[model samples]
Target: MKPAGSLALLALLLAGCSAGSGLTTGALLGDDKPAAPVNDAPARAFQVGTASARAVKCGFNFDPAKLKTNYLAYEKQQPSGQDTAKIERIYDVSFNGVAKAVAGEGEYCSETKTKTIKADLGRHLAGDYTPRVVPKEQEEGLFSGMGSGGSAPEYKAKHPMDNSD
Candidate 1:
């Protein structure tokens, strides 16, 4: 059997290493949890500035006139107030992601469909730009599909079955 004295010394050494304090004094004291690592995405005061503009255009098929009018309505109706550009960017990002996921489906979106996509997209962006609840109900028809009915858009016409000749 090994000496009991060696086992006690080994335990002390292990405890000191695990405690993570290089100083001898610290080994007698408890250790603190490591700091949470920083995320790479910068937290901007006006967050989503980069993504907002593109999102609005891509998600909503509104022209300057229409987009302005819809924004005005959002300002009037939404209690949280509007940061028109910021909200737009968030929607634009959401739309692009969803469109890409659906394989460029935004190209054929309708007014209602665009709004629906905006709502779904808004939810995702809300977490991204916290303390700012971007309105989900900006009524500009941004994309090109009707909310309910339409065939998936095709890039070119397919050959008819009759071509089997």
Candidate 2:
């Protein structure tokens, strides 16, 4: 009778051969430069765990479509970058409107809310991707004054304000 260890080795060889039949035994002996990438987005760095922390840096560019709306009222208020203070004031008002909407006050309604997020989003995008205006002292101080350690506000609406601004 065949020895137990020899039988197990034979079974393992059969399994490897059957599983990898598509790979020619000869190709393993060749010296080839690696295969070229398939398309624009790379595949090597995109494993499951690593992908969560990785982002496709704005590698591709896009054009502004006609559908895109101009939400920054501050742009109309001051097109030229000459007046940072006035632009910042308009931004503050728009941000306050956003905060009120987020607070469930709905001071800025559906249409106004859309305009508000857009405006703030624009200012944030334009100012080196940072918020152009800091919120007022009252808004800044609201968090420390809150009863809790400022967990999520007690309530939320379809649109919430960045009360911290």
Tell me, by lDDT, which candidate is best.
1
Error of 2 at 85 (Å): 0.8
**lDDT, residue 115, model 2:** 45
Against the correct fold, how does model 1 do in TM-score? 0.22
lDDT computed for candidate 2: 0.29
Candidate 2 lDDT for residue 50: 15
Each model's lDDT comes to 0.35, 0.29
Show model 1 residue runs off by greater than 4 Å: 1-72, 104-165
lDDT of 2 at 81: 40
Which regions of candidate 2 are displaced past 4 Å? 1-81, 105-165
**TM-score for every candidate vs. truth?**
0.22, 0.20
> Model 2: per-residue lDDT, tens digit, 33-145?
33222211111111110111111111112222211112233233443443443333333333233333344443423453344345543433343122223223213343444
Query: Model 1 — which ten-residue stretch has the worst lDDT?
Result: 156-165
